[model samples]
Every structure is written in C-alpha cells, then in structure tokens.
Target: EGTVYRQIPDLIFEADYKDRWIELQEAADPWKCTLPGELQEQMKPFQRLLFLKQIKEEKLITMLINFIQESLGQVFTEPPLFNLNEAFQDSTCTTPLIFVLSAGADPM
Candidate 1:
C-alpha cells in the first residue's frame, strides 16, 4: 500500500507574507484545537491527507511586478521619433497586473 506524506513548501508567496499565513498558523493553536478529548487519547493512523495550494492572483501579480520594476527601470523606453514608430513602443507603461501559478500533485 502507498503511504501518505505531507509536502511542505520552503517558501510561500502571498500579498502579506509575514502578516497573513504566519498569523493564521499561530492562531490555529493546535493544542487547544483538538478532536474530542477521548479521541485525542487514542492513537490512530492510516488516513490519507492532502493539501494543494495555488496562487492568489492579485497578490502574486503585485509581488512579481514589484520585483521586475525594481530590477529594470523604464521597460519600454524607445526614444527618437525618426520614422521608427514601428520599432518604438510607447514609453508609458503600467506595472504587470496578471500573475498565474499552477498547482500540482506530488507522490510520496
């Protein structure tokens, strides 16, 4: 039989990294939050569990674009209007607004 395993990620991204997930995990209070007292006393095993995570769209977009803009200033800065309008894209630009992440399964 195949065994169940938990795959924990080293780094996770979110709109507010330190503020959200960490705070929520702390508040979970697994010690205080429990099954029935009797159920907790008994040892049980052999159940399968899975947690698949996907990106939060807006947050991920904001995070990545912030990174890009910081790295490369004026992404589409094409100067000189010497009949080269085709090669030159508008200097004006907007920060990246769309981000996509794919979620997948892992076997253990």
Candidate 2:
C-alpha cells in the first residue's frame, strides 16, 4: 500500500521584533513630510538599515528555496511504483511513500 504524508513547518514570531519594525516605520514616516535635503542626513542611517535588512531577507529566502528544490530533486529522482503483490513477495520491499509540503505567504 502507498502512504501520503503532509508536512507543515513551525513558525515563530517574536513580539519585540514586531514592535521594533513598527518603531522603524514610525520613525521613517516623518521623513516623507519634511523636505528631502533637510531630512536626508537624519534619515540616512534608518534608510540604510531598512535597505540592508531587506537585502538580507531576500537572499535568505532565495537560499532556502534553492535548498528545498535541490533536496526534493534528489529524493524524487525516480517515480515511485506501487505494487501490493510485489511488496509481499519481496521481503526487502516496504510501503511506498509520498510527501506533500507547503509554504506560507512569505517564502521561508
């Protein structure tokens, strides 16, 4: 007999991290109201931090997706065959298996 398995990942979010992101958004909002030249110097560090964080997240996601694809490619290189009689005849044969994995809205 063939068996199917569904896998869901455990995701954890920190309250402090969420709060810090809100704070950054609040601090950056004022720059939009002020003149570019007046606030450019003051906002440079915040802008830089946000940009670097975005780049890091993008790279991490890309790496994760690549890793998952490579692993799956290796695992499922051959299509599985399901035969009840053959499985019984061959002592080495075990149950056939299938895995279904899903990701969330964010690629992680």
Query: Which stretches in model 2 have alpha-carbon errors above 4 Å?
Result: 1-66, 71-79, 91-108
| Clashing residue pairs for model 2 | none
TM-score of each: 0.20, 0.18
Clash pairs (backbone) in predicted model 1: none
Q: Give each prediction's root-mean-square deviation over alpha carbons.
A: 19.3, 19.5
Candidate 2 local lDDT, residue 88: 64
- Rate residue 1 of model 2 by lDDT: 8
Error of 1 at 39 (Å): 36
Q: Mind giving the per-residue lDDT tens digits that candidate 2 earns over 17-96?
A: 45544543444332223222222334344343344344354444433443444546544444588675765665543554
| Per-residue C-alpha lDDT of model 1 across residues 1-108, encoded as one tens digit per residue | 221222123223434344544543443222222322222234232111111112233243333444344445446333545443533453335633333446674422
